[model samples]
Target: MTHRQVMEALSGLLLGLFVAVLSSTVVSNALPHILTDLHGGQSAYTWVITATLLTLTASTPIWGKLSDLASKKLLLQIALAIYIASSALAGLSQNTGELIACRALQGIGAGGVTALAQICLAAMVPPRERGRYSGYFGAVFALATIGGPLIGGVIVDTSWLGWRWCFYVGIPFALAAILVVQRTLKLPVVRRTVRIDYLGALAITGAVSLLMIWITLAGKNYAWLSWQTAAMVGGGLLLGALAVVIERRAAEPIIPPDLFRYRTVALAALASVLVGVGMYGATTFLSQYFQLARAKSPTMAGLMTLPMILGLALASTVAGRLITRYGKWKAYLVCGTLLLAIGFGLLGTARADTDYGLLSVYMAITGIGLGLTMQNLVLAVQNTVPRNELGAASSVVTFFRTMGGAMGVSALGALMTNKVGHYLAENLAAAHIPAGRAVAGGGIPDLHKLPAQVVPLVTDAFGHGVGMVFLCAAPFALLAFVTVLFIRETALKTDQQG
Candidate 1:
């Protein structure tokens, strides 16, 4: 394909990518308002995010395997249709339970859109030339990440539009993507005997679901070492072992067991997991921090996060072009991971009263690191794998990254809840104030409704608790940095068939 053809095809793929990313992000800033309106607590807040990620993680490899066997364009459209329908249903949700259920359905579509977008790109572009295009993916991701919050914030703040618009806003864009895909995207389908690996899929999904349930509920509902934990953890491990066995013996495994034989695939998968943990776990709560801890309006919170998004956009575009020109990528990954660790470490010291200038600087560093690291990890795996295995290999890395994200968000959110609760208690006692209705209910507080005297305590508690979340995340970033260092660099294949 000529550059023009590639760009034309990508026009639709990127739009689909943008919609997938936007769905997850646009809700970030509005989550507080959504929770408050639904009469939900911190647990509900975490589950809303976790439900999407958990389903996305579980379904990614299945979608990837299906891409290898089916029509990429047709699959993409089906995913878009599912996303549009579920997103509309989500907007009509009357309770948090309904919202979470809808979000889970949305994730099933997102898994297809995100996994298939990259798989389709690999089908069109050579490994060596893919860096330039992958950069485009990163840019769209950054745009959606930045835009989602701003859009969500504005929608929430707008009385007529309300938070529901956040779910509805992406439908038109998704619909347009489907039309564009039908018009521009073209790929040759390989004919093969298709065998769906139902047992492997069921076992892996069950395993991930059990573990995620344990992670999300362990500390809050029961002690970590309790009987519920033992049963869930033990059951999850058994299911995971069963998945490995099923994969090894199955005619068509969802995750091919032999792929792990390549050191690049294994290391990239591990590093992606760590990156997801550090990136998603720590950053998911930033909007909450800005709103609850710093008392910024949702719109202002979105604006304040611009530095990070801009940094990501700039770094991805520049690094991608450089990689294409020079055909070297490891240095960028190394620097990005290092920067990620440093950024998380710096943010760990933040307080409610910390200067905005300093926070912006820290966020930018993190964003730059992510831009350099995330897509490149997938690119690295793609460069080394045969063209035939592209979907499974790419999805392997994506699946682990998303799984790490789900785990990080669930575990860290639980920790933040406990820490915030403890601090809120201590501070309230110190101030000789009884736990008011807002405080006692344990739901996310409406700052405007709180007593002026009690506001600072809530903010301070959130500030301290959120800081601890970043502190815990910093080590994972460092581990990712180390993991990337050991991946032996392979020259990207110029052959489009690679």
Candidate 2:
């Protein structure tokens, strides 16, 4: 395919990518409103996000494997159809439980879309030229990141539109992407004997679900060292071990055990996990911080995050061109991870009183780091693997990244819950306010409804608790830096099967 033909096919793929990314980012600012409207607590809030990530993580490898055996274009369309239907259903959800279930369904589709997008892209472009195209991915991500919050905020804040519109808003874009893909995407279908490892998939899902439940519920519902913890943790480990065993013996494993033998693949997968942990875990709570602690409107909260998005857009585009021009990637990866750690560290010091200028600077540093790191990790793995293994190898990295994200959100959310509760209690006592007089439930409190004297305490608790969340995330980013440092760079193959 010529560059023009590649871009033409990519136009639809990028749109699909935009819809997938938009689904997640658009909900960030609206989540506070969504929870408040549903009368949900912190646990429910975490579950809302976790449900999607959990399913997306588990299903990604399945989709990737299927891509190897089927028509990529057809799979992409099916995924988009699933997304459109589930999203519409989600808009009709009357409660958090219903919403979470719908979101889980959405994840199945998102998993396919995410994995297939990269698979299709790799099929079209060789690794040497892929960098320049990957930059477009970063641009699409930036647009979605920049737009989702603002769009969601507006929809939620509008008296008539409501938070449900956030779910419905992406349907038109998704529909258009499907049409464009049908018209422009032309790829030769590769036929292979299809043998999905259902048992391996089930075991992986069960193990991840058990661990996620344990992470979310450990300190809140039971002591971390209690019998319940022991049972869940032990059970999760057993399931995980079972998954590994099943994968090793299966005719076609969802995640190929042999892929890990390659040092680049292994290190890249590990680094992706750490990056996901730090990035998803810490950034997930920023909307709450801006709204609950800083007392900003959802619209303003969206605007406040622009610096980060812009930084990401700029870094990804420039880095991609440079990598293609010079064929060196490790230096950018190393610098990007270093910047990630520094960004998280700086954000750790944030409180309700932190200046916007300073916060923007921190966010920009983080965004630039992400742009340089995320897609490049997959590019590194792709460059090393054979053409036939592209789908599996690429999805493996994404699978780990998303698995890390799910765990990060659950664990960090639990930590934030505990810290916030403690601070709220302490602040109430310090203010001579009775505990009973404070917000009575774990449901997110509306500052407008609180007594004037109590608002500052709630804000302070959230500010301090959220800061601690970012502080905890910094170590993970630092670890990612250390992990990627050992990845030996190889020149990208100019040929499809070099």
What does candidate 1 score on TM?
A: 0.99
Q: Positional deviation of 284 in candidate 1, in angstroms?
A: 1.3
Off by over 4 Å in 1: none
Kindly list the per-residue Cα lDDT of model 1 for residues 387-489, writing each as its tens digit: 8899999999999999999889988998899999999999999999887633757899989999899999999999999999998999999999999999999
Clashing pairs in 2: none
Model 2, 260-297: lDDT tens digits are 99999999999999999977874578888988888888
Question: Poorest 10 consecutive residues of model 2 by lDDT?
Answer: 435-444
In model 2, where do residues sit more than 4 Å from their true spots?
none
